[model samples]
Target: MKYPILCCISLLGSLTAFTSSATTCPEILSSKQRLLNSTENIELCEAFQGKTLLVVNTASQCGYTSQFEELEELYQTYKDKGFTVIGFPSNDFRQDRGSEEQSAKVCYLDYGVTFPMMARSSLTGSSANPVFTQIQSQAGVKPKWNFYKFLINKQGKVVATFPSSTSPVSSTLKNAIEQQL
Candidate 1:
């Protein structure tokens, strides 16, 4: 009886996969990025297409570093509703020690971040990453410090930018997210 149930479950899983078709990622999200502490490259569009995103430029050593907990809470609450919090660790402000391994440890082990965090990259100026560059051009804002956040809608548009002092759990941010969803 147990073996039959297991077999049926496996068969159902296979059938579900067979019926589902893969979605093509949008051109805007086609840029390849690396996960923190790993060399594997991932296409951003394939991973987060059709999702409302809260993009944050984070630093492990910053004063507002505790926001990681709130960010994780936001992800836990709204993730099921097609919302995601994306983090990119940046050391441009000289707050971080410029170490990927340490950043990964703080994000994964210390803060217990379940949301996706990319490798360290510049968040402002000429050396900024493509994602940040596009966001700045569209929103007319640049990160003033570590922990700056940019909210992106499902259509890949920068809807809002929050400064370092804004908490991830703030009603203002939550309301903005709810509007998109």
Candidate 2:
């Protein structure tokens, strides 16, 4: 039988070492350095190593800001399951707090975002940052809106696309993460 796109990887305690443990940001950045956790320009393709990365283009003013609660829930639930949620604050939709510090602060204070959050960045189309563009090129998917979620499996492949309206706690998203785990 055909397995789900995420079934190729299983839930586990740590990131997969075999495929990505030693990878460096410089290496990935030969292509593009992804802004990581407020300041560092990271090599996203390698940083998570064998982990499933839930990449979302976030906006503070968007209606879906409430999804932050569920996002934290999912992170708490699966972080030990070898998954991570990467929040990339974006004003590409003109919905964010308008500054890197403001956006980052909002995510931390209001949403209780403990996950890695990049400084505000663009999500898609022409101005796509390296991380966003790389994922689309590698995963063969594109962002649909401000809150689009890209469920990437251990191998850095985009397993599924959860549209902006899909709650972070939705079963459809959870199922994909579970399958990867």
Candidate 3:
């Protein structure tokens, strides 16, 4: 009888986890990503379902690296309005080199980034991370350089792709973001 009860408990726990995960992410978005500054992997649906996102490929040592400040400004400005900016530190362009800790310090300590940032991962080519692959597949664009941004709507669809030169404060980007909000 005790064995049967234990099995039932295990099954119930599994079902609960499955149900929550299923409801957390929209079907259009790939839900898996490794969090920055840590060893944990996350399901995006679980963490950011129904939110507008500015997904950016970032580098710590690039000419565009200072965009982190504007990105953080955007994040702070619209976070309460269901907007978030997720940064992915990528070394595909050979701009960022250091431990994850060092990279994170640049984002958190130097730039004051408060939004979620993922671990270092490729953002272009065949070896790109799954999330980037999905974004590129749907959006029909790829990052030509660091700080390329994709704006995703609340329904998890890519609404626009902003090139590296587009400032976070650009009225065009801001208008696109405001529309989603």
| Model 2: lDDT of residue 103 | 73
Runs in model 3 lying further than 4 Å from the true structure: 1-24
Over the stretch 1-181, how does candidate 1's per-residue lDDT look in tens digits?
Answer: 9999999999999878755523344444658899999998888987898899999998999999999999999999999999999899988988768579999999999999999999999877788788988887788888999889999998889888899998999999999999999
lDDT (10s digit) by residue, model 2, range 61-155: 88887787788899999998799998877877778855666776667888788877766667677877666877777767767677789887776
Per-model TM values vs. the true structure? 0.84, 0.77, 0.84
Top-scoring candidate (lDDT) = 3
Clashing pairs in 2: 10-181, 11-181, 16-50
- Weakest 10 consecutive residues of candidate 1 by summed lDDT: 19-28
| Clashes by residue pair, model 3 | 25-45
lDDT of 1 at 41: 82
Q: Judged by lDDT against the true structure, how good is candidate 2?
A: 0.74
For 60-154, candidate 3 gives per-residue lDDT tens digits of 99999999999999999999999999999999889989888989999999998889999999876777887788887888888999999999999
Q: Which stretches of candidate 1 lie over 4 Å from their true place?
A: 1-28
